[model samples]
Target chain A: MCGALLVRNPKGGLDRPIALYSTALILLLLANIFPFLTLEIGGRQEITTLFGASQAMYNAGMGELAVVVFLTSILAPALMMTSSLYVLLAVRFRKSLPGVRVLLSWIGHLEPWVMLDVFMLGVLVAFVKLGNMATMYTGNSLYAFMGLIVVFAAASSSFDTHLLWHKLGIPGRKT
Target chain B: MRARDVGLASCHTCGLLLHLPASGHTHCPRCGTPMHMRKPNSLNNTWALLIAAIIAYLPANLYPVMTVISFGKSQSDTIMSGVIYLFAHGDWPLGLIVFIASVLVPLLKMLALLYLLITVQKKSHRRRLQRTRLYRVVELVGRWSMVDIFVVALLAALVNVGAVATIEPGAGAIAFSAVVILTMFAAMNFDPRLIWDYQGEDNG
Candidate 1:
């Protein structure tokens, strides 16, 4: 991780993450709008959206679990992509946006909480289990969710934090 | 030599090295995060959160995480039972994943954190690199434990059929989520630099 931090501009400037983040945000929006998966049993079908999972937990009275699922899988990724895009845009435009530093720091803290990759695996496991019980059909949002995960990884890895800090005029390590 | 030995403190949020004030704490000039020579009371906070997670791990495993109600019958599955059901039903790969992320990962993370906290408290100077790596592993794997919670959420959401069949998240899901979250907090509270703080006589 530190090695990734020290290497500056290996993939050129913020253009990669900027382009990738824009793509990710669009994908995220698509993921939220469409149904994620459809469950069919005995000629009845149930469609679940991105927020449906958390809503289910909340309905089951497990509000804490609901919040956890929502925050890690949904909210965190959205916040990360949007906030990162904001910082990158601020840097690109050279506009001294208010609270960019704090937002960047918050983005750093938000990194681990973005668990779309894990949630994708969870969806797969859910698929296998659901496949046994009933017929399952993947939805448009599922594809978007998968794409968001890929593009999110690209954007996050391609983002050069050291370069941004330099551009922000923050000092680096020194004795 | 450590930064503390030279009256320097690194910003936890932005990783900038700065001079420490003679008294009291100061915010990072660049990012405004509170600056400290080390995460103040790191071990205490980690131990408290880790112990809480350990306690939560009991209910997380012992109780049912989700209940499958189908055709006038109800079946509840604990974390272990769910994995067993998957493996018994020939879903070994997914079973293996759930087993690792839900069961092995959380247990090993807490135990590893316990070990690191002990070593740091003991001021043991051996294998600092390995301990640091262990801290990284703990931090990295912390969030993956949420995979099971997510699976439970997804299952409960999609398996609703209104009297034909329904899956509801059980108490264990909440407990399990608590365990994952507490361990994450425990990992974040730990300062890996403390592992290397015993390097020299003057620093000690």
Candidate 2:
């Protein structure tokens, strides 16, 4: 893990976890942009974006859960992926900063609450239950969400706290 | 066991893990009980949680997790069967996702808990490093087991039906709840401090 730090070589610094996080964050952003579903009921149609679901829930009087869903699914991932990207890129320039420990702890605490995979399950269950009662169209967004999950997991697994310190030439005795 | 050799005085009446002062042991840390090298109920409590988790895991897998009905036709799928259905229907990738998150992850947690409990009980000290890795895995993955439960709860609250298609949780819901609780208890009961303590003993 220490050797995998973003130290300069013949090529520029490219640590595995940093690379994983960048890819995951970009994928998550794309997943957010794409439409998860196109609901067609009684000749009316609306493509449900990830944001749209939260909005709909808020409109339906489940405001608290809506905020939770948004934070856990959207805001938390945004913070995680962005912070991860920041740390990884910073390491390449040997610019390690204080509070990396605190950020990693936050990531650890919030990781499970961000339930993209579970959200996918909710989508499928909605499809199966609404098959005849309502007509639903699957779209590219579903595919994007699937890809997003892999990128997210890879991003999380590749992250190593020790690597950040190592990049700054902080002695490798584990903090 | 020697107070002179280990450098901490013992209270012969009760065995408690206590913080000794610079000179010698002060008092019984817990219940004002005299102190010893080992904690009394830690091992037993961990084993109880582990056993409960293993038992709960069986029903969590075998019983129907969710029941879905469409147009007066109903079908039920347990966690394993759900994954199998996903695979049979050519949703193999999604099948893998459910298989791992809902099924394998929880079981891995149970095993991890068991391993931690046993190793702590036997005082195994070979892999302090690997034990830390396992502990993290168990702690992190513990709540993803709630993924299935969250789906169930959310859908149950969202979709209500009298004659149209409906969704209902099954007996496995209780068992799955137990899996979540038992694993959480297992994580909490297995002391991480024990890992460092045993490793120090091995080196000493």
Highest lDDT against the true fold, candidate: 1
Can you give the lDDT of residue A9 in candidate 1?
A: 62
For the second chain, the TM-scores of the candidates in order are 0.95, 0.74
* Model 2, runs deviating above 4 Å: A1-23, A39-47, A51-72, A89-98, A108-135, A153-160, A168-175, B1-108, B111-115, B122-204
Candidate 1 chain B TM? 0.95
Q: How high is the DockQ of candidate 1?
A: 0.62
In angstroms, give how far residue B44 of model 1 lies from its true place: 0.8
lDDT of 1 at B67: 96
* Tens-digit lDDT track of model 1 for A134-162: 99999999999999999999899988776
* Per-residue accuracy of model 1 over B1-204 as CA lDDT, tens digit each: 667777987677777778988863798877878888778898999999999999999999999999999998999999999889888884798889888999999999999999999998888888877888888888998788888888999999998999989999999988999999999999999988888887784344
Evaluated with TM-score, which candidate comes out highest?
1
Docking class of 1: medium
Q: Given the true complex, what DockQ would model 2 score?
A: 0.05
Model 2 backbone overlap count: 1
